[model samples]
Target: MPSSPLLPSRPSLLDDLAHAALARACSAFRQSGSESFALPPVLVDATLGNGHDAAFLLSCAPPEALLLGTDIQPRAVHAATERLAAARQERPDCRVQIFCRGHQELPQIWAELPPEERQRPLLAGVFNLGWLPGGDKSCLTRAESTLAALDFLLERLMPQGCLSVHCYTGNAGGPEEEQAVLRRAAALPPRRWRVAYCRDANREDSGGRAESLVLMERLPISRREMRVAGLCQA
Candidate 1:
């Protein structure tokens, strides 16, 4: 008999879980209806390495949704640009914006967006942490910057919006970075955010150094309510 479509044919990997989280977020957003927003909602790929995540997000995001991507390396930006060119052509209604910048600068970049775009709800974001594959290993994400970026995104994420972070703990400083991310996620108020950490427990490779995936979703509550409850800033 053929494998059931509902069940996975193979064990789920970190990427599989991350994409599943994103897909769920997209589905929720669609159910919420686009009429809630004055403009289409936005999705972000914080680490647009090779554009694979960006492509996946674009495929799942609602029609005309704006997809923003960023990378510190010019080569990565170029590669993603090329990789996404066909998708852009195929979906002309959807807007694609690529930036050659670090994730740490996300706040400043967001501040510079037009008022209308800034007002659009942030539906989802993806962050694949650590060094870029097939690139210089010396240039990798750090805890300080990554935390700063997460702070900004969490503050702005729309209620019911989700963010997926895949942290590879096998790289230099990776263990420290993963711990910092987990601490931050755990610190979020339960009334306002839902956070989950997934990893392979039985894996013995790399002396128990396994890739970790953190999934976070903002609960359905008004910003005003959160502020009134002292859970968020005014």
Candidate 2:
């Protein structure tokens, strides 16, 4: 006999027995081996606010892998550390490095790593600019450092990896910085980078309609060719 493509793959139950019962069982298996595949790449959370992003990064990779979280404010760093410490309760097996410096100095951090390690792929780099939530309002991410970090990311970001930018444009100097970043994003060529801009899902971001989330991916091709393709795509 021949099999029918439309037939069910699993056996069907015939008797209801005048009652219905359903149960689902989930079993989690423990994994002991270290990630043997080149440390599973690196991830950079440029503004590690509350450490949520850092914690998530650590969760995705094994403990020996490299994960970096950076911020310029001392308080912000403290908050991230505290948050990460809490996350350790759930994910005690992961490792992460935190930096308390502006993004403009990332090149120095990259230089400090071993030569062979520097060539490893970058998984993802994210930026949440503007002031820290419920923290200091006087301080914020500047355009200079943000752009510098973006340049570094664009150069070294892993293939198919994404960089997400969240910007707040209502505060002082925020609009100008947003404008500069938009111009820079607009200039990216299709051959080297693919971009998608979306509205933040939080309701708090609704009233202003000024906040934006920008995601960019580095393509496999060169910038010149990408730029030309972008012209044609338009």
Candidate 3:
């Protein structure tokens, strides 16, 4: 008899887990009652690799929302632009901004947005930290720039807004980048930030290729809630 297949040979569990994380981030915006906006909510797809994440993000975004996609490689930028264009043909209302800039330039681009746009709620920021699929494998995200970009983006997150990242630790230097991101997530204050991290249990100790997802939400802190926490501490 043939040996039983492991885990029933279902779809990619890690990918499913990451997708759920992104969905939760999108739902947070809906629950926060932040939908009243003069302009549609803004979203950032920081590393637009092959545009899969960007497409998913556009699906979850509010109508006419602005989606910014960034990548350092010309090929990636071109491919993502094409994918997003097809996505736009399907949903013609939404607007997209494609940039060949480094992901680290995200903060700068966001900073230059019109004051009114900045005032609007940011629904979500998604990142896939690795090289472009089917392209150069050596050009991976670095810890320093990735951490800096995360910090900059998180500081601007509207209440209930979240940042989600899929970190692929299968390639050279990828594990260290993921670890740095985890350290940053660990350091966020619980009172103001809610973070969720998920990794495949089967790959935890195998020292093999693995992917992890991290979601960080900036909590809406109220005066009453702060006082209650202070009283409890006292």
Candidate with top lDDT is 1
lDDT of 2 by residue, 1-234 (tens): 888678552211210110011000000001312232334456787888777656655555544456778998888899999988866666555556789988878889888888865765565777778888789888888888899998888777644566777777677776667767777877888776787665445535324447666667665544354345331121
* Winner on TM-score (1 vs 2): 1
Question: Measured by TM-score, how close is model 1 to the native structure?
Answer: 0.87
lDDT of 3 by residue, 110-208 (tens): 788788666555768888888887899888788888988888788767656778877878866778888999999989999888888988666642354
* Candidate 3 steric clashes: 0
Clashing pairs in 1: none
**Ranked candidates (TM-score, high to low):** 1, 3, 2
Per-residue lDDT for 32 in model 3? Answer: 45
lDDT at position 130, candidate 1: 82
Error of 3 at 15 (Å): 3.3
Residue 93 accuracy (lDDT) in model 1:
79
lDDT values for all models: 0.84, 0.64, 0.75
Native-to-model Cα distance after best TM-score fit, residue 106 in candidate 3, in Å: 1.4
Indicate which candidate wins on TM-score. Answer: 1
Two-way lDDT contest, 1 vs 3, winner: 1
- Candidate 2: Cα lDDT at 86: 66
| Model 3 vs. true fold: TM | 0.82
